[model samples]
Each structure stands twice: as C-alpha cells, then as structure tokens.
Target: MIVSDLWRYPVKSLRGEPLREAEVRPWGISGDRRWMVVDPSGEKLWAGEHHDMVTVSAARTGQGLRLRAGGRPDLHVDEPVDGPPVEVRLRGVGHAVSAGDPADAWLSEALGRRVRLVWLADPARRPMSEAHGGRPGDVLSFADAAPLLLATLPSLRQLDDWIAQNGGGAPLEMSRFRPNLVIDGDLPPFAEDTWNEVQAGEVRFRFAEHCDRCAVTTLDPATGRSGKEPIRTLARHRRWDGQVWFGIRVVPLNEGTITVGDPVRAEGTRSSR
Candidate 1:
C-alpha cells in the first residue's frame, strides 16, 4: 500500500499536471483548482458544457505564472497586470475574488467566449455537494468530495479490463479521472467505496464519499474530445446509489507533504451505507 502517483489541476476542469511532491491546503493542494474560468455573466465555465477548451496548465515562476497548452507555445505573465473581481460557484458555493488577466484571456480564446479567471482567497470555504450530505450553507472545498480523490492501480486495471471486455478501448490513464493521488498494491476495483481513513506518508485523510462520474470524464483531457465508451462501460458495472461513482473523496485529517512512492494504507469498510 504505497502512493504510486500524485497530480494537481492548476485550473478547474482542465488537464492536470503530475507532481513529485505537493503541499496540501485546507481546500486542496496549494495550486489545485485555485483558479477558474467564468462567462460574461460571471458564471463559471467548465469543460462539460464547453469542451473545446477551458483549462490552462501553469506553474509559479518567480512571482509570475508560466503557462502551456496542447498546441500553443508556453506563455509567461508577470505581476502588476491585475484581473477583474468576480464570483464563482463551485459545487454550490459562491467564491468571490479578483484574479489574474492573462489566465482570463487565455481561457476565453480557448473556449471562444468571454471568460475571466478568478482565484480563491479563503481556501477553506467550499461548495457543498448534495450527494455528500451538505446543505446550502454547508461550504465545501473546490473538489467533488473532501479535498482529494485517491485510486489504486489495481482498481484502474480492473476498470480497464472491464472496458476492453465491453468493447471500450484500452483503459484510459488515471489522468482521465483527475485524481489527486494514485496508489499501488492489490486492491479491488472501487475498493475506496468503504474506506474511512487513508494514510499516505505522514498525511491522513478521512474518506467521506464516492465521486460521481460526469460528462467531464467523457472528454479527453489531452485533446478535449468526448466519447461514450468509458461512460457506457462504467454504467454497466459502476453504478451505485442513484449516481455513477468512480473515485473516493477524502478530507485531510493530517496535513503534510505527500510524494510519489509513499505507502498507502486504508482502514474501515470499502462500502458506503
């Protein structure tokens, strides 16, 4: 039971980057989902509705951001060029703040709409999901569940096997799910169903709920193309409760740096009541 892979999506609903080590924050990993694209109405934009483009991968470079895309060259933006203030709804919470402009333009052109980028200042506040026993006022992080989602290699392999048998292509990489962590070791597919606590390195997270699949999963993160195979295959065997869940959501109990290759351990049932 060791940590096999780690990832972070600098922007919401877009391609993510693998990380060797990541700093966990109250909302999520430091750079994970800190920024988002919004329409002219200030409503947030997502890959599900507008799949052509909506994400911009970036890194902190000396107080600036270095960005990259599938076919575009790398872009750099220095400070001083401030973005507009806007409110964005995640899950169901309204996060208000001003953000950087370069990110806004980059995302707007990608989606061919007027969109802006906004950042979260109070990372602890979240948009609670109805699936997670949350109320209108019950704030949640930017994630679907707690703060992170974890999956195992064996579990992914199981899904791949199921997909192949059902005429779906090769099992797509875990990146398609945009999980924060990928663990190794022999575990049943969707074993996260019953986990309550998961330990990785010095960090411990409380497993709270299973992540439901969405149209975003059908879109290719790399090419932004959508298909029905994965969704159709998953529907046959992965449907649970009233929704189709595929990953486990977790809330961090202990905060610390988590790196790849760390042993992963789970305690408790693998099924939800």
Candidate 2:
C-alpha cells in the first residue's frame, strides 16, 4: 500500500489544508489542530453543531494563519505568543491562549455568532482521555480523538459499491471522514480492523481505536451542506456498538516525515503493541 493524501487542520472545525508531505509527531501532523473556536462561556464550538464553522477555511501561510470564507475578505492572524491565557472546556478542563480580539472578531463575524479563537499553545498540558483508549504519555491536539485517522481507498470503494447496490446514488467522497492519511493498495476492504501498528514512510503508529461517524460527516466540507448519504449508508452496513465506524484512529510511536507515494505496511496484529 502507499499513502495517497495528507491533510492538516490548523484550527479545529475549519476547513483543512491538503499537503504533499508532513512531519508526523506525537501530537499529530506538525500544525494540526493547534487552534480551536470557543464561546465566551469557554465551551468549545463544533462544526457538527454549528454548521457555519465548516464554511470558514483555515490555512497556515508562510507568515501566519489565513482564514477565508465565501463573500468575506480574507483575514490573516498572527500567532498570539504572549496573548492572555483562557480556560476552555474541551472534553476536559483545558488551557489556551486567546488569539486576541481582531482574529476573534473576524471569526465571530464569519460564523455569525459570538466566538473566540483560542490556541492550545501547549498540547501536552491536557491529558488524553482514558475512555478514548489513551495510554500514558499520549499527548493530544484539538483533534476529536487520537492524533491521526487513516482511511483506505479499498474500503471506501466497498462502501461506495454497497451504497450503489442499496439505492443507486452518487458515490460518497472521502472528505466526509476527514482522514489525515488516505491509503490505497491491493487489500480487502475493512482490513485495517485487524491492524495494531502501521508503518508509513519512516514513521510508526499504534492503533488507538476505530473512528465513529457522526452528523458532521454528513456535511460537505466545501459548502457546509448537510446530506444523509454516507451516514445513512454507514448505519446500514458499518453500524456496531451503537456507532457507525469508518476510519481508524492512531497515535504515532515515533516521529518522522510522511509523504504521498510513501509505502505503507500493517506491521502488527490487533493484540501486539
């Protein structure tokens, strides 16, 4: 198998940036999920709940962060190095630094609500939740679960075939799942369910858990339009344990650069490492 695509989400919920290569670290890709949106009350906002968030695209420019949305002028935000600290509720009590009022105002104006941009300056400050299969020393970014999510083209093809046989609709896009790494190879669909470790390029990662699909997957990342194809289709065939599964979450065991076209191999059994 080989890596087909790589992506990083510098800000949670906002659209992600596709890359040809990236530095894989313990927390994930180097710039992934370093920032997130929160309300004045300190509750983290999610695109799954506030669909408008997906409309705003965020990218890391050579200088700083750039945000763009339909009809709105593009805005550039500098990283707040000495910015004021703020307490944000992200699954657990977490700490972050405010991105200041200008960035906050721009984001709020775009999302059409009162919101603030908070950067998780130190991802290690928050412990990974044990309930989500976190192990010791497992640092987490603003990513929903583990550090990375992997999806295979073969598996998506299988799901697409199933959807076609069911009702003959359009094929679902892989963007629906927002996978960090997309792999393609001569393997059976759902073969990753048996993997405990994977080696991609020079990096090695241990499996964390199967990623569950939610309403967020029903929304198109480009237009923020919600649909019922993938989610509805996943429920029919991939449903189990009260959740519909798609990708697999993993945490890096070693840091290294991973690039598109790099070879990928499943290295361990489900019980190993």
Note the clash tally of each candidate: 10, 0
What is every candidate's alpha-carbon RMSD to the true fold? 3.0, 2.0
Question: Where in model 1 is the C-alpha error above 4 Å?
Answer: 54-56, 60-64, 77-84, 90-95, 127-141, 270-273
RMSD of 2: 2.0
Name the lDDT value of residue 65 in candidate 1: 53
**Cα lDDT computed for each candidate against the true fold:** 0.70, 0.87
Superposition error at 184 for model 2 (Å): 0.5
The lDDT, on a scale of 0 to 1, for candidate 1 is 0.70
Error of 2 at 254 (Å): 0.6
Candidate 2: minimum summed lDDT over ten consecutive residues — where?
A: 264-273
Tens digits of per-residue lDDT, candidate 2, 111-224, equal: 999999998777776667777779989888888888889999999999999889888578777877888999999998988877888999999988889888888888977788
List, residue by residue over 1-273, the lDDT tens digit for candidate 1: 778888987666766778898877655676777655677676767778888653556665555556677677776755323554566655455655655666667766656777876666556666556567443444344555566777778777888898888777766877778899888887766677778788888788876577788888887766778889567877888886666768787767656888888877899755453
